[model samples]
Target: MAVSQSSVFSESARGDAALSQINITPLIDVMLVLLIIFMVISPVVGLNLDARLPQANREATAPTVPPLQLVAQADGRYRLDGVVHGLDTLRSALVQSAANDPERVLMVSASADADYQAFANALATAEASGIRQIAHGQ
Candidate 1:
């Protein structure tokens, strides 16, 4: 039996050329798996709170007493009923007002460009000064 060197060399070259071609089937399979995983997990990540809708009631009554207005300025100053006050005297002023009219509602009217901390401070002062009801005004 005689084996030709040319034939052996040709077979080796064919095998090497086959290896040079890229195999994309595995890469496509991995990409499809990642896409499916993201599609399944995306909705669950945003599912946070489950809220109950309130039933409509037509017989609700309105409040009788007028609300006290407290305005928050852009410069961190507060105005309660046309009197401007700073943070140092805010709590005392709220307490005095509450003493006069215990049933009056405390309304905070924050400026359009006021900082969030200013509004929060006004709310805290009202609550800490023994005011029962508090609300935000336009």
Candidate 2:
């Protein structure tokens, strides 16, 4: 008669050797499941970004434009800062000077006997040529 070998393994030194090699397939599968879970949830949950424009409290600290002194004489002649200017000369001067800074304040000082039309013409001319900030006085 012949003796046969048994396939059963007891919890002893023989089994310990078999258990030494860890089965990491389950750990890797769990990590892959978690990665897929995060990837699927990311699209549903988006990031928020907000940006606002300048408010009423905000102030601009830019260089100011120089003032323009325009005197409308009673005799229908114009003078720019005390310099005598003929009708045509005055218009050209106003346009060139104002071109340097359209925001420059224009102070129109009309004499007591000056025609209202004369002053109006100066103002209209300045305004038509894109000159804003016109101030009138004596």
**Per-residue lDDT tens digits of candidate 1, residues 1-138?**
899999999999999999999999999999999999999999999898889899777578655777888998899999998899998788999999889888789999899999999999999999999999898898
Residue 17's lDDT within candidate 2 is 87
**What is every candidate's alpha-carbon RMSD to the true fold?**
9.5, 19.0
Candidate 2 lDDT over residue span 1-138, tens digit each: 553345343446578888898999999999999999999999878966577776774466667755788887878888788888867788788888778877788888777788888888777776776767888855
List runs of model 1 lying over 4 Å from the truth: 1-63
The residue pairs found clashing in candidate 2 are: none
Query: For model 1, what is the C-alpha lDDT against the true structure?
Result: 0.91
Give the Å shift of residue 90 in candidate 1: 1.4
Count steric clashes of candidate 1: 0
